[model samples]
Target: MTDVQRGTEQASWRTLPGFTTVRTYQPRWLSRDLVAGLVLTTLLVPQGMAYAELAGLPPITGLYTTVLALLGYAVFGPSRVLVLGPDSSLGPMIAATVIPLVTANGDPGRAVAYASMLALMVGAITVLAGIFRLGFVADLLSKPTQLGYMNGLALTILVGQLPKLFGFSVDADNFLDEAAGFFRGLVDGDTVGPALAVGVGSLILILLFQRILPRVPGVLVAVVLAIGCVTLFDLPERGVDVVGPMPEGLPPFVIPSVPLEDFGLLLAGALGIALVSLTDTISTASVFAARRGEEVSADREMVAVGAASIAAGLFQGFPVSTSGSRTAVAAQNGAKTQVTGLVGALAIAALLVFAPGLLRNLPQPTLAAVVIAASLSLADLPGLRRLGRQRRSDFVLALAAFLGVALLGVLPGIGIAVGLSILVVFNRAWRPHQAVLGRSEDLAGYHDLTFHPATTHLPGLVIYRFDAPLFFANARSFRDQVRALAAAEPRPAWILVAAEPITDIDTTAADMLGDLVRGLHEQGIRLVFAELKDPVRRRLDHYELTDTIKPGDFFETIRMAVEAYQASTGRTWERGPGSYEIPD
Candidate 1:
């Protein structure tokens, strides 16, 4: 076929009849969405501020994050109920990037600028990645690695928030020192009475509500109770650390200034943030899409997330990703469209404008409690257990990621995860499965490979099936196995490779196969290929290996090869070429 006709045929295959399904958009589902939106908004308000604090920025920045992300993602995002905003996952990452650049006391303005720059960089990266359909890059961080990384992050967040909960300040930058500071403070009983009482009370309320109410917003309830108690008793005056007055008015749009010296530093941090953010977003989107029986375009979702982050950055917000908790809340509350998210954003904006004072009396301990409680859900013990049970190698990967985060840092942890995932890929490719196959007499029209030791090889012919793509990693092993098979006693006159499972052949493997074919030809044996995919065939053709092998040697199916062999032999051979024959 001509190149144009071949291209057309490939395009037609992608849109085959069975794969073309339409999406059903239901506008009527919005009738009860307002109530759901209200519930989600209530939960989002305090959580947003808490995450902003976690990100080492002013709490109001969290409000800005909620406004822009919700609106932006609602319009472009694929998921109807995915709530995008300030995320705990991105909190430590932002802090890691911003903390080193700013002064010890923290430059609120400069921090905001840095955050915007990081957001812009991340947005650009995501958009470019989406445009290039590089969504598969997220798979570089294997599931085990993510589990470990999250566990370590949860511990770090819990440790970092402890001082705030006790109304004491720690000057530690890293996780180890922060943990040590927490323990020292605990041992010395440096906890402020009012802050400790409020923190412990909030924790109790959240725990009780979660156990009893189950469906209600436990953290929101805890916040309300804590704030109400602190306000009624005037606890701040008695030494309780309160959030104190928040800035009013909408976030004004301003371009962030980047220092020429720090451009490389900021860019590197942004790349790390972008990769993790995309990984988290795609994963969360896939989970919801699967539940709804909806298909998610990962590349499109990346664009949506990128747009949200860019909008947020410009509007005085930091990096954001899809929140599993918020998405669950939206889904459970029956959100049917992005309108619910838009409504939630409107609600938060109203809160920021009108009730800014209400947050002033909110105790820092209560906010810490909120963060600790939210992070606890992200620990993912069940996922770790599942990984251990289903995939042992992945279990080790998860452990490595967890330890990397705990012992090293977020960046190092991510580096370890990616490295481990790549190693796993290479390990699999290095030693792919190869098996001898034969026709099954007991089964109708089926080929079965005898895996038991009692089965013996047939004389004069050998059939082998390679269960992976032919690549440079395993080319040497492939050559060794083929040579070994040819040198065996009662050497096979014909060696048919069941190429159905071999998806692609690299240049190195193609050259090795060509040499193997020539070697076999000199040894008075023929090398045949059966059930080769068009792509693999094209690669062989490109390498000029097609001319070396006779046209009739490349059978479309193993059955065709068996039929051809029987016709050539014409002995009514008791069994097929590779099959063991029993004396009758």
Candidate 2:
């Protein structure tokens, strides 16, 4: 290719993910994308409105969030078919962050502005993270921690919505308080029977459709049917609260303005939102990419989702995330590219402009039911069961996370989960498993001496295995274990370390090793290592331990180390029953 053409291609490759997708756009995929977009629109409309309500924003703002986020993702996203929109998981977070700041003012517009600014901050942080290629931040939430957080969030959401589902307005804070209010309202007979009927009926229908039909748009059908029933029977006159009319046009382009005094609070909330949003988006993108046998660039995904959040904020909407249900609809309906998302956005916009009155009679409780259904899916009881059965320690961590979120509020619960995740990682490394190696008749390779009582150890030789990286936290433990082995009654002349699992060695560990070597030499017990990695060996050289311990002390394999020990001692070896061999 020509140099100019090659340079242009390289620049294009470096552009946003959507640009690359569009550059290689296939004409035949347009029809499929259009169909997928239409199918996705069904779920988007109801979910957008419901999640917006969940976030304590006007229902119309959900449409705005849905449209702008989808369009933004379509223009910048890396995935072929990921959908971005108002999410159930993020709704409570946004509400918690923005509500307190705006509640005193009692100004709905200011509340929206604060939420939008929060989204803007989230966008800025996420974009910066992407620019710096900090995709590893997603690993902050380990699988068990994530499952626990989700389960807790799910319970909180479900309980919080119970008041609305029962057709009563309860003024309370936190999940437990709200639940108490719900029960009190029930005892007082404050719930409107008609609204309760609509909500419970809608939830049941949606669940049944999901279980039986699978292919049907259960949420859309339930919502539409509920709206029709309410409107046809004049349920509003019978005490059912309706969504009321919404503005019939696109969202206005406005810069969100927040009070300077509240900037710190917004910043704090934004950090939490960004963490949750990016984690959810990256995870959803990874899952979809894996199913299609494609690789997802975490940095690119971050940039795409960040751009979507910024777009939503600029359009007077709160932050958004990858929606599992909407994305599944797109994928199941044959979405082929980001074009599907763009089409869905346009479809939502058209609905707002032309048919805003169609859902005016939709019952509020039914919307709550929709959100509650989504929250139910997030519970993940089966995952908890699997963790309990597979790894008991992980199960404890997961259970702790679940309790933290369920009992505490969402934001505080997330903080607890993060701290616990760090502890779980540190605990593993701080007290990692160690073993002594011996030849066992039943095992192919060397087995742990303590586990195999009948296994035999070489005379005057001790093969110790430290199965973790040597760092400051564990360095002392390593020294203690080695010294204890040396102090044993049958003191070994040669202590050979199977260093294959010791991937890294830090400065503290190097110093510890230096001390260990000098102490072992005084006892006439040689300290040797077998199968040390090149990087670790280089680290030892840098520490000047190579001069203290001769280069010949390190060997490539256990058998080679044994051979060298025999050669140094001028000993002869022969094979017999229950004996080991040294290969030439």
Candidate 3:
């Protein structure tokens, strides 16, 4: 390439967040980033390995995935302090995706290959979604359902880790079976005392340190102490399992070539993974970015996430997502830029290259303890409780989601959450909130008649408000409500609709409106509209329903509509002894 072309390319590279951060790098911030990165690296190693085991992959891939993901996001991601790695939330999901495809023959290598392929596909999906500006896809899972799903997932992970933490393996499928197996084993005196003590002790140490010393790396300290204890006491002789050291070096960069027939299944898994990953990334980006008084472009964040996944996939790693705990750790330690991520990535890489056997004596139960501790953070029981006490419908939705995940499994739980979201939206729009409006003495222009029971009402005018877009599903309800308003005592001369809440009008609704207009005219009653938006007006014109109502029937405000009614009918509303209206 020519020098000018190369310079242009370099200038284009400046669009990347990491490059910009480097070009405008501040020297004073370097020390803080260095220290924060080192601190973050301590959490990354154990959590990465633990989450990998949670995903049913070998421990080493977690470290590999973490290094590559951090490096990749630092280059392309929008948020500077957001950390990416193998997340506990994605662990069961990754296992759900690849284990079915790999477990038949019990080949660990085959599981790795399927997971890598899954990551590549997930990357492709997220990148395309970003390029197309489809960040709204994250809304597929609503807040209540997401809470329910996470609660279910956390419980699942906690239970699954019980066997490992107790120093035994229980062969089971699904949450119930796993729970049953654990309890059955416990009853059978199958728990190894030494392993249980180490695991439970490690768990207690991590949780206590987190609560007592928020700044310390509890997982690192617990791992160190456990390893030392194992080494000093030779705990392996007591049937205690250790993670053993990772492979000496990173896996080679190779495109995972899986059986073509598995593509269909893997693609299904990828879609679910991509959705959860992007939703999580977007939410995290919003939070951490808000802390610094900045906003993150969701599209750019999605692209960055895709790049991270692809980077990890090439190294035979699994799906990864942002870790709120690790990011908080970095920020707490004064991370100033993506350089912290780069520094952390490089430091982990150095460990992999130089001291591959650093964790050789790391007890497997300690790893299980790490996972259990992380899982505890994933649940939000208070949120679930608040939901239950706040709204009955939302509480029902959350309960369904929780049950779906607990009984059905992780992937199906996501499917349930998304489905529930769609249903709730439809239910709201279909029934909606309708109100009859009247002028009250204490209120300003108008108020719901249900609340202002004594408000003044004009003898020949009725004002109605429907708080939803006019769509096919609710057209008939609108028709019936208007007809009921018109049928009330002594009948009305005009029905004036408060159109501000009716944001749009579909063809079916327009047709229904035309019919209502004709019927009102036959009864010598006029139909009128006020505060209709221009877009809805244009839609009415397109539907040709404007031809049904005289051009004079439309008003820009309720005041104007009321004035027109008084001018034509010589009627007015005012506070009186019984009725607020005084007929002229």
Candidate 4:
């Protein structure tokens, strides 16, 4: 290739998303980006460290992760205003995956290594998925399931943080155990009065500001006030834990390397984490993209998030995902592009280098309070209530997912959620909705017999509609319905399938149809199809079964089929007395 062409090709790949945003940078948006960036840093610092703590990592690692993730996403992420960082949802998953893997002494460094490795693996998985255009994997968890999982997750986080909030420690792992341990501690008088005062005061302050001053960053306010209170009252002497001086400067770029045995476990956790991250990112991106009048490129987003994950992992940080709350804050503050993220990252870097002790006096319980507030936002009881009122089936699915997460550990909960979602999809296809068609005097087309029971049908013909594709799972159901139609009193001369909804016919279904056709022929009944899609017809022909279905059995439309049937049988449509529906 010529040098110019080579350079141009390089430029094309480089223009994945973020760089294009840079090239087309608007001068008018700079001030807005700067201000929004500064405003975002307020939440970024506290929440990042708090989430890091939540994930069983050093608080400074959260800052490192936040900085790298933000900078990396700015270069690759398609969404201009989405804020990527350590998230509350991912924290529990990280802790669940990494904490147990640590040595008996609970090596902090080993935990960091495992988490960073997980981030790397998650990044690789997401990037590969994006490259293969597997972005639709994000739909693995349906909306109801997602809501339930989040609610369960919220409860888990809230309970897990309660011990910290009450100025005590719990020696339990899972949510149930932790809840029991927390209560036992409460009864044993583990609560530190002064520490509880600081924690509750911070929690109330954050909640009050969120409720009364929605625009203000309540987390930052709470952090500042809690630090002041701890410092002025010398709360550390009264049994309150605090974050001390952070490690100076940025972490050098170095990949986290863990034991080979841990690779399988880390990768497993990464798969679940990657899926959740993609689902969370795509949902948040869609909302922000719609608000800005842009279409969401989910694949690009997955790749971007992957890049961000890799960057953070290399810097000894855990996995990151888009924060909808943070994005909303940035958008509300007039953020125009990733420049806001750049500002936030740089500000955090400055804090690390210039003032590592800024939050030294901030109480650990205050951080717990920050996490509790975030967890509160994750629950959606109103959404669950709506699901219950809207449809019982949907409510059941949501409730099942909720129970799965609440009872099982976080990683296992995700597995159960995915499994339940897949089962729901398979059940729909396994026993699909089938309808018998009859003519209504006032209607334009044939109507479902179940809905319009008093409609008319020709005496010797039956029209059946199966509302799903013909596949291995539902093929038997379809055959049984057809057999039932053939067995009716004065058995139908023809059983015509309204094939519009049967989008595809798989090989197993094709063989089933072939056998059914031969059986019906012996019974003196002809099978006919109307409104069949061309692709499906092609598949039937490929199976060499179309020729066996009689020369003139297929018709372009239901009307054409009716006309042919009427002409051949010399019969007109008959009116049924009272209600008429399929016997079985």
In lDDT terms, which candidate is top? 4
Q: Order the candidates by lDDT, highest first — what do you get?
A: 4, 3, 2, 1
Q: What lDDT is obtained when candidate 4 is compared to the true structure?
A: 0.90
Model 3 lDDT tens row, 1-584: 99999898786664477877888889999999999999999999999999999999999999989999998899988788999989998999999889888756588888999989998999899999998999999989899888888899999999999999999998887999999999999999999999999999999999999999989999999999999999999999999999876799767998898999989988988888899998888998899999999988989989899999999999988888998899999999999998999998999889888899989999999999999999999899999889989998898898899889889999998899989999999999999988877876787888776677654667778777899999999999999888887777668888899999999999899899999999999999899999999998988888887679777889999999999999999997755322222121
Candidate 4, which ten residues in sequence have the lowest lDDT sum? Answer: 575-584
**What TM-score would every model get versus the actual structure?**
0.89, 0.95, 0.96, 0.97
What lDDT would each prediction earn against the true structure? 0.82, 0.87, 0.89, 0.90
- Ten contiguous residues with the weakest lDDT in model 1: 14-23
What digit string (tens of lDDT, one per residue) describes model 2 on residues 373-460?
9999888999999999999989998999888887778888788778888898898899888877777667777767557643445567
Flag regions of model 4 displaced more than 4 Å. Answer: 1-15, 577-580
Rank all candidate structures by their TM-score, best first, as comma-separated numbers: 4, 3, 2, 1
Better of 2 and 3 by TM-score: 3
Residue pairs in collision within model 2: none
Candidate 3 residue spans exceeding 4 A from truth: 1-15, 574-584
Q: Which candidate do you rate higher for TM-score, 1 or 3?
A: 3
Alpha-carbon RMSD to native, per candidate: 6.2, 3.3, 3.0, 1.7
Q: Can you tell me which runs of candidate 1 are displaced by over 4 Å?
A: 1-31, 444-457, 566-584
| Alpha-carbon deviation at 407 in model 3, angstroms | 0.6
Worst 10 residues of 3 by lDDT: 575-584
